[model samples]
Target: MKKVLFSAALFFTACAVSAQESVVKEAKSAKSDPVKAAQIIEPALTDPSTANDPETWKLAGDFQKSIYDDENMKLYLPGGQADTAKLYNSLAKMFEYYTKCDEVEQAKVQSGELKKPKLRKKLAKTLATVRPQLTNAGSDAYNAGNYANALKFFGLYVDAPQNPLFADEDAVKNDTLTPLIANYAALAANSLKDNAAVIKYATIGKEHKEEGYRSLMCLAEAYGKGETPDSAKWLTTIQEGVEKFPSQEYFIGNLMDYYIQKGKIDEGLAQMDAVLAKNSTPYFMYVKGVLQYEKKDYEGAIATFNQIIAEGKDFVAEAYSKIGDCSFFPAQEIVEENSKLSMDDPKYATNEAKIKELYEKALPFYEKAKEAKPDNRQLWGQYLLNIYWKLDKEKYNALEKELGY
Candidate 1:
């Protein structure tokens, strides 16, 4: 029985030695036939003695990564697709194998089995070359309409340690590509409707110095769409975007709509007032006018609109339009009051005169707006028809004919 057991142990040892030698030979020749090479070496990754062997891990990693590198070459061969999914899978495996190699190498160094600084530096150099490849894969996936896969690739590129292409893990600042990657990842998550991932990446991306406002917008959108929507967080993000990118009406406009929908016009006005106090830019001035108009502070709106005109801003037409809108409200009020009274009532004539005066006051601003924005003929025609009805019936009839009314 003892002799049989010894023979079995010898047989097993010989088989292990043969397997190791095959793996080494495969690794050496993998460049020419990487698929067959990988098939031979992958089992060693889980084998007890080889699993912790740095050389085994390194060989597997280098061989698989070479396979991944050659994938694009296959597309030039006859009857071959790029097979991006397969390429991405190979890259994923490469990263895993490289990471395992790193772990084993570090363990070997700690155990005094290897002297390491040189080996670690070489591994870092290898990782640096691989980093941008992952980013390229992400962009390719995104262009191919594979957003989830794009997210996976970008996430790996940005999160990998010692990537050299991105900023440190503590923050992704200073690196332009870092924000770009985060933006792409966030957009991918948005396309997938993965609200949580959108919030995650977008929130981080919002710290980007040059393009943070875009990320803030994404975060706001994500918050509204996420499960159990957080309106407060959404509002805060929108406000931040408005403050950071005051010239960008997209954020301000979204905030305005949010306030209007929630019946918080006064709150919106207060927020705009704060923004106006800080910068008083032409855009913010225009926003202040809009907010005041929504709050029915017509006189304040007209004054703010005038300030935009004084600044010689491009929003002059819009300002004139708002000023005309201010006069419209008072004119409407006079007409409404007059409608409640009989024509013979003593105050009826007085109200009619007041209404005509207000309409006349509004008409010039509307005409100026029309001159500034001639393409807005429909808006001008509507306002002119109202003014002509209050003052000149002949002109009203002629204008109505020209307007196809």
Candidate 2:
């Protein structure tokens, strides 16, 4: 009875080994038919006898790559139409399988199951060759408004340089498109409202030259959002953005808006004062003037703007316009005060004269603003119309005709 039981155990063990070898051989023979080969070998991945074999995972990777290639090749055929969705799906699967194969091989090497990696070079070469396609796939999905998939593909491409498959490749290290792809991934994350992902990618994206400003803007926006917004980080990010890109108004404007929204004008002015102490640029002076204006310290604003004008920088026109606003807003307040009194009131005429005096003060500055930026209607057009109407009707009518009003 003992001998018979031992024979049965031997038969079962032999059958398991035979099943593993038989499936492997049959899968290899059907390699030309990628679909059939994949179907035949699918079970081997989880089969107790073959699950630990690196060769099984490698075969699976090859089948997936073959499926991707077969579908992609249809694009060159005369009447063959390729399904892009299927192509990208297979391509992603190919990458996954290849990554898994590499992991399994490494694990085997570590476990003393193999002397060295035999497939590393081949796998690395294959991954390098196909890496750029991930960018193309991401861009296509982005243009199609598939933000989630676009982020996925772009993330894969962005991370490929650091991937183990490209550990020895210098070309991957110097790839210039990584930063740009990171920008795209950040844009996708922004579209998806994934603030964490936006910060993640935008931090990397902001290192790119041509598109770096946009990434910086996105980073600031992400830092300023969410349930518990980091106001300090948001301000710091905007300040850094302004320092790096002084010509970009978005960063400066956001910085100023934050001060206004949080009623921290004094804090903003102190910081600006500190900045100006080191190197006073006309642009920084203009920001200071605008902050003062928002704080309703019109005299201080006018003084700051006058300093900008004295510097004879490109901000001269903006300085003149802001000065006009200082006088104009005061005149408007006088007009409101006069409206509250009766025409026979003693202070009415006095207030009226003061209003005219302020309008007269504003006239020259508005004229200068118009001369500096003739095409910029926002700077001077409407303000000049009001000033001229109050003080000179004929000039107002003529200017109105010229503006096609």
Candidate 3:
């Protein structure tokens, strides 16, 4: 009876060994059929009895990664191409498995249970190659207007710490592509109107030397678009951007607008003054003139604008127009207040004389502005006609005929 029991146990043990052998053989033979191989090894990867086996994890990784092979990817992935969103999940899964394989193998190597010189090198190559795949996926998603997925893919590339190629220096030093990736992510987030995401990604790019200026602008714009934006934060970002990117008119212009919006024209003037004190650039001087105009300092604005014209800068036309505007404002204020007054009043002649004097001051600047920028004839044409009507009806009628007014 004992022998009979032993025979039965032996038969069962043999059957179990044959079944394990069959599975291993099938796993190896199904290399071209990664789907089949994956099915064979998945159980071993999860089974507690074999879960700790590094070889099982490595097999799982290999099978998953094989799904991205040039031929296999086209056949198995969506879009029937290597560079489609359909391959994103597959590529992501490959990265995950390979990371696990590397981790388990490295642990075994540390414990003196494995020797993986060739495998470690291979894993490094694979991780580096995965980076471009992620980038391609991101580009594909971006071109498709899948901004959320574009951001996700780019973020994955930027934050992928499991990559052996980046494992050493990624934590301590910034990657050369890090800023560009963050910038792209910010662009994607911005397209989606994800203000928070724009702030987050652009902040990363803002620290980079090459992309910092663009990132700062993006961040500032994002802050301005926020539901409950912090004006101080927006102001700070624009100021910083202007300081760092002095050549970028967008930042300086944005900074000026912020001050104007806050009713701090004096502060804007002081800021422009400080910038001019360092380097009296034509643009800066022009901006100072604008701030003066906003402050209703017509004389100061005219003086500053004259200085801009003297600089022989490209903005001379704009300066001339702004100077004309400065002269017009006071006369406009007087007309608005006293237009209702009867000509019989004693004050009428005095007011008319004052208005004429102001129009005279504006006339030459408007004429020069038109001469300098004939392409913008329409810009100051109405003002010119109005001034002419007040002081010279003949010129007004001529200009009205020319402008079809």
Scored by TM-score, the top model is: 3
Candidate 2 residue pairs that clash:
none
Against the reference, the lDDT scores of all candidates come to 0.78, 0.85, 0.77
Candidates by TM-score, descending order: 3, 2, 1
Model 2 misplaced stretches (Cα beyond 4 Å): 1-29, 36-52, 71-84, 260-289, 295-324, 331-405
RMSD of 2: 6.3
lDDT of 2 by residue, 243-360 (tens): 7776676886787777888999998888678667865788888999999998999989999999988878778999999999998988998999998999999899999899889999
Q: Which ten residues in a row have the lowest lDDT in candidate 1?
A: 164-173
Count clashing pairs, candidate 3.
0
Tens digits of per-residue lDDT for model 3 on 127-153? 666666787778888999999889888
For candidate 2, the TM-score is 0.69
Q: How high is the lDDT of residue 314 in model 1?
A: 66
Residue 120, candidate 2: C-alpha displacement in angstroms: 2.4
**Each model's number of backbone clashes?**
0, 0, 0
Which regions of candidate 1 are displaced past 4 Å? 1-31, 35-63, 70-93, 96-125, 140-146, 161-180, 243-247, 256-274, 337-349, 377-381, 392-405
Flag clash pairs in model 3: none
